[model samples]
Target: MTSSLLFASEGFGLNLNVFETNIINLAVVIFGLYKFLPNFLGGMLERRRSAILSDLKDAEDRLDEASTALSQAKEELSSAEQKATKIRNDGKTRAEAIRLETEKRTVEEMARIKQGAASDLNAEASRVTAQLRREAARLAIEKALATLPAKLDERAQTNFLNQSIKNMSKD
Candidate 1:
């Protein structure tokens, strides 16, 4: 390695210190990077990290808001379902009431019609009975007159009228 590293002296260089030269080059590069690169790159990295963190915070806040909104929507949906059930029950109740009322009305109307028909029938029967009675009384009076006239003189007529008066008084 020593022989490989040794070189023939050129015209102006007989002595060479490679280790010191390498160390000096390394120092210069290190100092140059330290002086300029840390300030610029570190500042850029910090700014980038801050922007990323801010975006993450905003996203987290948006996620929370969205979850809250979703919860509220679910609650509203549940309430709406309950309201729909109540409305359905109310409608059923109203329909039942209407049916009952209609049935009651139908029954009342039937009763009224039956009563009116019965009244009409009774009136018609009473009128027929009265007419038959009047006809029967007229026939009886004619038969009595036809049978009584063969023996009826004025004296007999007077005696018959007196007997009729006496029977009526006894009754």
Candidate 2:
């Protein structure tokens, strides 16, 4: 009974052969995991890195495009502002020119009107003077005819007729 208890190989005894076999199996599994898992996990990690780098590059390109578009918009805005200023200046210039031309035309028209009025006044004065002279000559002729018959007697009329006939023959 004492020998059976001390040499219990099939129960709780420290069997070196089984222990060595377990150790060998664990070492083989650890070696297999170490050999194959790094390659598989490394391939997955490399693909993930490449995807991240591609996303970063695409973001940078988009940023550059946005910056270029913003610059172009700024330039176009400046150009439009300049054009508006030029248009405003041109409008002012044209308005000034038109105003000056209108003023000149107004002055010329006033001058022409004044000249026409003066000429009309002078013509009216000349017509009135001529009419007055003709009226005075007619009145003088009438007065002389009314007094000539009473002043000249038959002998004086004969002498006047004889003198008028002598003057006509000398011409």
Candidate 3:
């Protein structure tokens, strides 16, 4: 192994000189990168931060608009419910009024019919009474005519006839 190391050192000898290793070039490049990198990266980072802020502002505005719209919708629904309740109450009142009116009319009509029927019955009774009186008067007259000849002689009948004629002339 020592022999191999000696052969390697003779074939490719190590240089101790700094200029031959290019150390100054590496240091200059490192220094330039350190001085320039922050300016470029700072500008990019500032632009990204402003863009994120703008997006956050837009999101907040949209949320406010959505909240306002939801409140308005709730108010409209409440108003509609009130209107529906009012209409239902009015309908119930109207129906009750109609039913009461119908009942009143029915009672009035029944009273009128009953009165009419009673009036008709009274008129029939009065007519029948008058007819019975006429019939009784006719029967009495016929019976007197049939018995008149047996009760009166010819001379008496002649005298009664003369008396009836005199009474009619006086009236």
Best by TM-score: 1
Ranking by lDDT: 2, 1, 3
lDDT of 2 by residue, 49-129 (tens): 999999999999999999999999999999999999999999999999999999999999999999999999999999999
Of the two candidates 1 and 2, the one with more favorable TM-score, higher being better, is 1
Model 1, range 23-107, lDDT digits (tens) per residue?
6888889999999999999999999999999999999999999999999999999999999999999999999999999999999
Sum up the clashes in candidate 3: 0
lDDT accuracy of residue 122 in candidate 3: 91
Question: Residue 142's C-alpha lDDT in candidate 1?
Answer: 94
- Candidates sorted on TM-score, descending: 1, 2, 3
TM-score: the better of candidates 1 and 3: 1
The 0-to-1 C-alpha lDDT of every candidate, in the order given, reads: 0.90, 0.91, 0.88
Q: Which pairs in model 1 have colliding backbones?
A: none
- State TM-scores per candidate: 0.64, 0.62, 0.57
Q: What is every candidate's alpha-carbon RMSD to the true fold? A: 6.7, 7.2, 6.9
Q: After superposition, how far is residue 87 of candidate 1 from its true place, in Å?
A: 1.8
Instruction: Identify the runs in model 1 with alpha carbons over 4 angstroms from their true place.
Output: 1-34, 142-148, 158-171
